[model samples]
Target: MLFNIFISDLDIGIKCTLMKFADDTKLSEAVDTTEGRATLQEDLDSLEEWANKNLLKFNKTSSSSVERDLEVLVDNKLHVSEQCTAVARKANRMLGCIKDTTSRAKVITPLYSVLVRPHLESCV
Candidate 1:
């Protein structure tokens, strides 16, 4: 059986929260500023140390990679360019729904309702 792990320090205001479902585990932190990024890095280092102490091996290669220097929107408002890329202009199929480029039209099928709707609705 897999044991759950929880680590929180109220005195230092450090909470390394994680959500686990079956074999999937996710860790998230808001790093909008330099200090926040440093804290998150420190927390990750501590987590690595704890895992080593417990003899729990982690897959470092499984971590996702983000493309650097890409412009991201904030608060749903465009900050950089108004033009959309070709990939962004095409329809995206997610959770059984075909979301249009403009997001003005959505195509949903019966399969979506039976399989994808529940998973999408349960997302936090």
Candidate 2:
């Protein structure tokens, strides 16, 4: 609540869509044309100015080719295969780690339920 109050004016001068969740802020606009790209850039500049004025710093390492909205990976075509594959890969990694750490017969069920199930359930 205090953080929200401090940053409530973040969208005051932004023209594009501004999504704020916890500490993450995203500027979204369709960049199908030169004008749209220019507008998005202008909004980005404004955001930077705002951050500077407010003494805030943004995470520089959080960018990704696949955009995530509300914790779901999304692409232009809105296909689920990428999300499914990512989840499966993560779950497999966790399973491998669990296999190395303990005997499967002893802790597989509990470990899978605690660590791996959420990744499998993330898609669809």
Native-to-model Cα distance after best TM-score fit, residue 14 in candidate 2, in Å: 0.7
Distance (Å) between predicted and true CA of 106, model 2?
32
Q: lDDT for model 2, on a 0 to 1 scale?
A: 0.86
Per-residue alpha-carbon lDDT of candidate 2 for residues 3-117, written as tens digits (9 for 90 to 100): 9999999999888999998867879999999999999999999998998999998777765557766777877576667788889999999999999999857688899999999
lDDT of each: 0.47, 0.86
The clash tally of candidate 1 reads 0
Give one digit per residue, the lDDT tens place, for model 1 in 1-124.
4253332221133454555555655555777988778877887777677668767766877433332123332222322232223223322344324433234334346545655555444321
